[model samples]
Target chain A: MNLPDRHISLAHGNGGRLMRELIELLFAKHLKNPTLDVQADAVTLPLERHGELLFTTDGFTVQPLEFPGGNIGSLSVHGTTNDLAVSGAIPKYLSLNAFIEEGFEVAALERIIISIAQAAKAIDVAVVAGDTKVVRRGEGGGVYLATTGIGIKTTEINLSMSQIQPGDRLLVSGPVGDHGIAVMLAREQFGLRGDLMSDAASVLPFTQALLDLPGLRFMRDPTRGGLATVAHELCRGTGLRVNLDQSAIPLRDPVVSVCDMLGYDPLYLACEGRVVAVIAADQADQALQRWQALPGGELARIIGETESNDPFVVLHTELGGSRILDELEDDPLPRIC
Target chain B: MNLPDRHISLAHGNGGRLMRELIELLFAKHLKNPTLDVQADAVTLPLERHGELLFTTDGFTVQPLEFPGGNIGSLSVHGTTNDLAVSGAIPKYLSLNAFIEEGFEVAALERIIISIAQAAKAIDVAVVAGDTKVVRRGEGGGVYLATTGIGIKTTEINLSMSQIQPGDRLLVSGPVGDHGIAVMLAREQFGLRGDLMSDAASVLPFTQALLDLPGLRFMRDPTRGGLATVAHELCRGTGLRVNLDQSAIPLRDPVVSVCDMLGYDPLYLACEGRVVAVIAADQADQALQRWQALPGGELARIIGETESNDPFVVLHTELGGSRILDELEDDPLPRIC
Candidate 1:
């Protein structure tokens, strides 16, 4: 073993010799940024002297760590950023906690770290701290990630749902269901694909751009149960009716066809690189154009509006009628983003 | 349907009607908080204008959610808080992400949520956001909790290993291995118990007590792989050696005897609610006294010193011999959180 090994075995995460060797060699070698090398029991980060620090934590258990359009490494970055972004803060630092299965390839681990580093750099955030542990075989499903983000909030922004108004219009940036379908196709679990790409980009910018807009009540990334679920949430939380224009909702032909084939509704599918906005009626058009200007938000459009009557989500049909959109019975797509 | 369920069944964790009904009537009924009502794709929170928010997240998967000192619910809170506390932050908020097995029981779920609420109340941390999902019957073990906490960090405190020197003193806040051993005893798989109770309590006060002490370099709870990993870690990182007086290392007699019986070292075992501190050699005496005055830190002791030799952790054994302390060989105390 004079030459360093290039993979993480069960022992690497077992808190034993291999674990030490792995950290001393692989992770510590590339992760040699200033903070981690301090080797403290816990990190003492460089704190901001002025405003309040915003903090958030998230855990990821998406079955396959590597997926189409993205992997767990990139997802971890986006996941943490999204949390801070929705909290009305600018994510500046992150603490990553990884639980890995034994026998994960060292090459693969390096790839992941490189991916994480690249993603972190892309988002302009730093991986300031981390902890890694290995679970025994048959006990873990390859890998799981738990990341905590630290952000600094300025005095200017306050994004809260309690501030939502009665007549605010709802807008969604870009076409939906791409991310859900992309992962599904990547799994090849369904043996389906057709120009469907995972919309797994970060929403930090889109939301950041709209922060200064006048009367921006609330903004959300339609993940998990997607637009329909979030739309239902608006009505339920604010006791307002939301009437969605079916034609106004952007969708790719491939996503629609796939949804039709699978008996899944595109409206209810997850969208990672999308934004759901609840803005003042007057600024709705401006928000749409602003979103369109961003790389990830080309298909921006006005999807719906909040109303006093009905007090439920009602979708205006392409056939000129309306139908009540109930809360999603179940997630049509799982492990998306 | 009429007979009360004795064990967890598949319908409880399913995201179907049964799952919704169980959450609404059982878990939600007990853990009711304005923020817990979130069903949105992402929760929207209002941050205070002045306070820095600290956030941390952890995934709870300790074999049995219902354990000796606490269940998964409470453990989730404690585990997350410990992570946040070790960072020298004041824990203020938490996000609970639950992955429940399809057949989980409503009654068990209720017990878990109540424990969570109690844990939150005990720490004065609010459960501000959460996500719940149900897996298929065989997809999950029982219930896994991923709790994320947020806390505000004070700007003045600077705790890092770079502060350690050759003459720094080592301290342990309380007896070690109690929590790890207690969990194993509860499993009864090894048919062992020895008056060992869990050291599972909030250590925030103890941590806060030591933050600003002039002698402090860094502190950490000797959890997971316990004191040895951290002791070895201090030396390994800063190129300094740590020599611990075994006679001074506090351990309950029962814990000592049990580790002896199991062919393990108490130094390598886990401590749920203890802190290991590095203090200036001159101030070690007063630091020990302060720790001993606290309920959680009552068993605190000055057990070691930083050195340039034995980059490995060296113990001055009771029998006048020494051993090169290494990392955990295997998970000696599994599910011992």
Candidate 2:
């Protein structure tokens, strides 16, 4: 029997002939890999010796589904990959689950699947397993993608908040808030229009550059809550104070202008492809230089320093005044990924 | 700051202070384990020596969110766990990603989370990492769960269709169509109301019982599209034919009644806690006896045998006549999980 032509139907998820056709024609056709077996309910892999395993999961509910620099498909891969990369792991395999609405167009689903395939290929990660489910039209969003990533930690590098010292230096990789602004522009909200693109690329290379740094204490990808929220989390239960030099931080002109027009602070806006690293103060300059030489880290800068006294994040404004950058209380925008 | 008392909002997924509070109060409070660290983006685990790693993913979109015997939370855990169990692995860790609607009630979320914790605890599996995303009210079903399970294949027991041969016996753990019937009854779509409950539970014990059996060739948890679909898959490309005895397959009275009333085939409906196993014909009785002694395997029986002549599933009716059990063409029910 021929599969449905235009829109996805419940039969595609029924685990029968049509579902088998969908998997073969759409998923396997694009995301083919040696480890992916449609007949097997689970994929088996040989464990890498002398390596610790890292596991991470994320859900992509970004509005518009497709955005300026990337779509939800690529974001799903990058989100999980970045999580493992920041934790000092080499991403290897991924499991994807797509919850598609009944009325969603099959062509769009194919495009997203292709993007997912391309993103995984670029990072040398395999889409080893996947599941699909269809909800009634109004009951589901366009498509919510959830990805689980498994990586192997090959290095002895340990990055955690517990190892952070008072003299640690906080560095920001490239500009902030590009992804949030890009999503907002894609929604056409606030009558906003620009050529701005999201910084939604993978941070694997950026993270790798600092992986060997002896003084690296902790690293994180500032995705949903941006750089400031990451800072707040780093010092929340600890007696560490993060003092940020706002003027030294890098920001794209369009992102800065967008933040100015709206009441949103770029520091708190999302960045799908940026990393916040805490390194020793003595090695901060060398780390910044190494990052600047990389492709996505030309604008890397040491923007803050940790103190032993207060437990709050203090931002020194361009006007020489200081204020506490408290944790975000409300949702500035939703589905920004 | 206090978390919202009533319903979930976009703020709860913003990765800000509210999201943190939600995680700490609801998810962390219930699903907390040594591997579930709030501060880490990914969890690190030590690898099991001499064991192959198994990975599986599944999305649960069960309607009504809560059903007679299990809710989506428990279903999510059972679905992924069963997939691994049937693959000859012991489930170790799970990564959960929740896509919640804006107006979903907090009380319901808490209940579901508690159920997830309970289900994981029953099997000694850990929810090592998780993610939460909230979509707008209309864009999301109340809550959709996606889970990825990691398991360790400790033994050399390989179970796959490639190992199946002619004259192999097919055995089922228990009654069929209970999950589908239970969900359909919960929907009240057909004015159906009874004490029918979903057979949604962990199949680890059942799968474990037969792990060391030398006659076991393959095992599968008949889920969506059920026994018929699994039979179709087992013989599709193998030039093998499956012959099933309709009278011998165990069926709950209510499930049989519902299928008869609705003109639905019980073999085509879903089953959550059932396993279809292929064992050597000579050892079929031994496997059946072993399974029948288990708690959920009271009705275990050898209901079918595979042949090498044809590639279709031939069903012998109660009248002693045979017919083809074709693959499901359209969905009789959606979001049945």
Candidate 3:
């Protein structure tokens, strides 16, 4: 059976004939698996006897949903998976809940579904359970997606902010602000264009590599408020001072140019796929060398280190002056995912 | 620290200082537990040695956000918990994600959070992880919540539509249409008022009681499209005919009057807290008696029986006539759940 060749109606969320058809034809067709095919209220997951489970949830509401590098569909998967990855867990399954506007196009929905399926497949994760709801046309954006990810921690690694100590070196996986810049240019409100794409991809490989390193203290993805915000949180949580060498932080040319033109700091812009980690100061050099050898970590750098007992982020600029990096106060961007 | 005393701005979702304050002062303050207090990328849950895990997710966008008996906050918990309950699993943890409109009131949000915590506590579940996003004022309803629940099956029961047989009897927990009617009246569009309260609560106790019964084949909460739609799904899945006795169905007087006035079929309206189970015909009476003796199942009824190979629902009306129960074709009521 074919779906209505038009926009989605409230009937599509009625949980009856049309809803079942939409699920079977669209969702199931793209994300087919034994667990999902059961169509039960809940999917039964078979787990090995003893490891701990990782749980994460995120809501994606990126405007102009389809962007240069990825769309909201791919962003949702990457966002949740990255959370699990940074926490030393192997992402396994996800539950997707979609809030669609009543008149959203079926074609657009199908494209997003296909993208989600591909993303999940690439990361070896299963879409085990899902739910959909429709709101009146103006009551919702085109679509908003919330995802819950479940992962398994197989290794005996312990990562926590409390482990961050004085002299611990900080390293970032790649360049900062690519995702924020890409999405901003796609909006076209600034009359700027760029070929830059978001660094949005699974960081499982990079995180896994660091798991074997005994010097690793903690790791986090620099997402919503970017690297500076992450540094601020690490300082706040551990009651330590983070001194960052701003010149050492890597940035793409376009990102640098846009930040200069728009009076934005690259450190405050969001990154869809990047990680910030603390490694024992003595092993910092080895960690950087190893990371640089990896594809996604080619631009990795040792940008900063922790200092004793001061709960603030201090930026050491190239001009021989230092400034305290304060927390964000204004809502500079909306729906940046 | 205190949350900003104003409408939620985009800064609240910026993953910076304001965002942390909002979460710590509001959500975490109310739903706080050891696991959630960790504030890690993901909470690592320790499960017992061996058992199949159950995963379910649902999005709640009920209009007016609050109604007589419960609000969207409590409804969100009940909705996801009930899904797990019907699967014969013990509800454990939930991941909550909320999308709030830019100008939504802080007080209303606090009220909602308090309700959620109470609901979760009553059901012996933990709010282990959560995420929040704020959309532009008009891009969302006041607030929409999506919850993912993880449960464990401790019993050896395996329930599926495939287990439904020709002689299986259908039993409903209690009266229908209370939730849908209550929400409709709360909207005041119909110019009707009543003391009607939604039957939105956890069905854990009810489902837990039936887990020990061997005659129980399958169970589902007749939510979104109601009992009639559920019957249709069972018939379509198993290629069986369901002959339902309309006279045996239970209804509250206010619900019946409202349905009559609006020309709405009570059979097609939603029930937030109810169950429809398929039991062996010979054991149906015992199941009914046991359910009727419970707190919320005072009006439990054996409403129908399954017949082989017909693949449709036949309604034997109180007027002594039979008619085909067609699948839901349109949106009878939106946001009922």
Candidate 4:
């Protein structure tokens, strides 16, 4: 069946002929897989052996539809899968939900769908089930995606914030705030432009390398509220003081320049493809070496450490001055992920 | 932390203090379960045994957010779980994604969250994971929800549209079009009002009773595009003619009256909580008896049958005349689901 319209219409979501054609010619064609059956309401997934299952979900509404390094499609896939990866699980299957606006360009939708398929294939995960809905033109952003991921835990590594203890060290996989600055530049809302690309890729390699380390207490991808927000969560979760050496943290020049010019703090910006890991001080160097050797982890750093029980985050500046980093209050960026 | 504002702000989704408070005071407070941890990046789900896993997803963007019988929250739960139910699986876990518009009322959001928790509790399904995003006011319909369900196929009954034979009988668990008419009435679009309620309940009881039946060929919940759409799918899928006896198909009085007044067809309307099943001709009576004994299935009937290899749907009217029911074209109601 051919989709005769160049732009989506309300009829495309009415669950009728148009909807079927949209699914057949666009979504189904691009995301074709053995597990995806348009005729079946539910798809069956084969589990070789189920010991433990990891489930996570995330919603994406990044503006511009297309960003420098990734669009909402690829970002949605990575956002959900990264959550599972950081939790020490082998990402397996994902279900997608797309809420599109009427009058959206069909060609752009196809591109986004193709990106989704590619990103899922990159991680060897299947887009097993999906749904699409079109809202009235003004009632939705150009496109919004939500993905729910199912992963299997193949190892005995159990990571959680509750496992963090005083004297633990914190390491970041790579530079921070690239995704936030890149997306901001794509928006062009501030009369600024740059060639910076979003750091929006699956963090599976970083997490997998450290899954075998017994000292790895927890791992989380610094996303919406960025590195400082993650530190706040750790302090609140473990009631321990988090001390960060600001000079040790990695940051790209473009991101730092953007932040400096816009009065934005890079530490509170989002990063899609970075990991903040809490590890025992004894194994911190080993963890840092492993990440630094990976493709995207050349700038990986042992950025901080946990101190006595005070439940606060402290940033030690390069000039030998220390200041408490308050929990994020106002939103500097919205719809970032 | 107390929410001082009555309406949602962009910061509530920015992964900051307000977002954390919103989750803790609203979502976490209402949908508290042992498996749900707001601080965790991903949650671990325990599987007692290995078996076939059923996965399905659905997006909900019903207008008026709150309708007659139920709101979008409960409807989302029923919508995704019903897909699993009709597939002959026992729904085990669900992951929810909410996209909220800025300036939406906090109290109303709480109400919807409470409803979601209630609906999940009613079915013994755990909401294991969730994510929330807030968009600018004009970029979203107050609240759009997407739910992905995971189920375990405990029964040996394998049902599919391909299993439907030419002589199979079609049974409807109850009346059609109540949800569509009820929502339309709630909208008061045409200066009309009615006390009719939506038939938006889970079809688990109906599907469960017939799962063991040897003659149960296929089962589907008539949702958006309603029973006629399901009939159309049956014909197109199996290359068989669908003959519906309009006189035997059950519909409520208010729904019929609304359709008659509005030039609408009940068969094309949506039904949130009803089942359309295909059974062997010889076992049609047995299936009807089983459904009729259930509380909500009192109006069950053998409404149609499959015949020949023409791939079309024909409605046999009460006056002994028949007309072809064409595939749905324009959307009568855009956000009914």
Ranking by lDDT: 4, 2, 3, 1
> Alpha-carbon error at B283 in model 1, in Å?
3.0
lDDT tens digits, residues B207-258, model 3?
8888888889999999999999899989888999999999999999999999
Better of 1 and 2 by TM-score: 2
Over A1-337, each residue of candidate 2 has an lDDT whose tens digit, in order, gives: 3324678888888888778888898888899999998778898965567778999999998889999998999999999999999999989999999999987888888888989999999999999999999888898877899999999887587888988999899998899999999999999868989999999988999889998889999899888888889989888845699999999989999998988989789998999899999999999999899889998789999999999987999999999999999898887878898
Among the numbered candidates, top DockQ falls to 4
User: In model 3, what lDDT does residue A32 have?
Assistant: 88
- Candidate 3 chain B, which ten residues in sequence have the lowest lDDT sum? B1-10
lDDT of 3 by residue, A1-337 (tens): 4444778888888877788888888888998876785368998886665567899999999988889889999999999999999998999999999999999988888888888999999999999999999899999989999999999887488888988889999999899999999999999999999999988888887788898888899999998889998998888888999999989999999999999999998899999889898999998888888788898889999999999956889999999999999987776666899
Ranked by DockQ, the better of candidates 1 and 2 is: 2
My TM-score estimates for the predictions, one after another, are 0.87, 0.98, 0.98, 0.99
User: After superposing candidate 3, which stretches have Cα over 4 Å from the reference?
Assistant: A1-4, B1-5
Q: Positional deviation of B228 in candidate 3, in angstroms?
A: 0.5
The RMSD of every model to the true structure, in order and in angstroms, is: 3.8, 1.4, 1.3, 1.2
lDDT of 4 by residue, A73-188 (tens): 99999999999999999899999999999999898898899999999999999998999999999999899999999999864778888899899999999999999999999998
**lDDT over C-alpha atoms for residue B45 of model 4:** 81
Which 10 residues in a row give candidate 4 chain A its minimum summed lDDT?
A1-10
lDDT of 4 by residue, B1-337 (tens): 4444489889999999989988889988888899988888888887667568899999999998999899999999999999999999989899989999999999889889999999999999988899999999999999999999999987477999889988999999999999999898888888999899999999998999998889899999999899999999999989999999999999999989989988999999999999999999999999999999999889999999999857889999999999999999989888998
For each prediction, how big is the interface RMSD?
4.5, 0.9, 0.9, 0.7
Candidate 1 structure quality by residue, lDDT tens digits, B1-337: 2224644444333233444566566566666666554443333344453444444445566656676777778877887787668767777777776766666775677788899999888888888655565554555546767776666677566677788989899998888888777777677777776566777777788788877787888877777778888887787677888998999988898887877888877787777678888989988888888888987677789999998765778888899998877656666665454
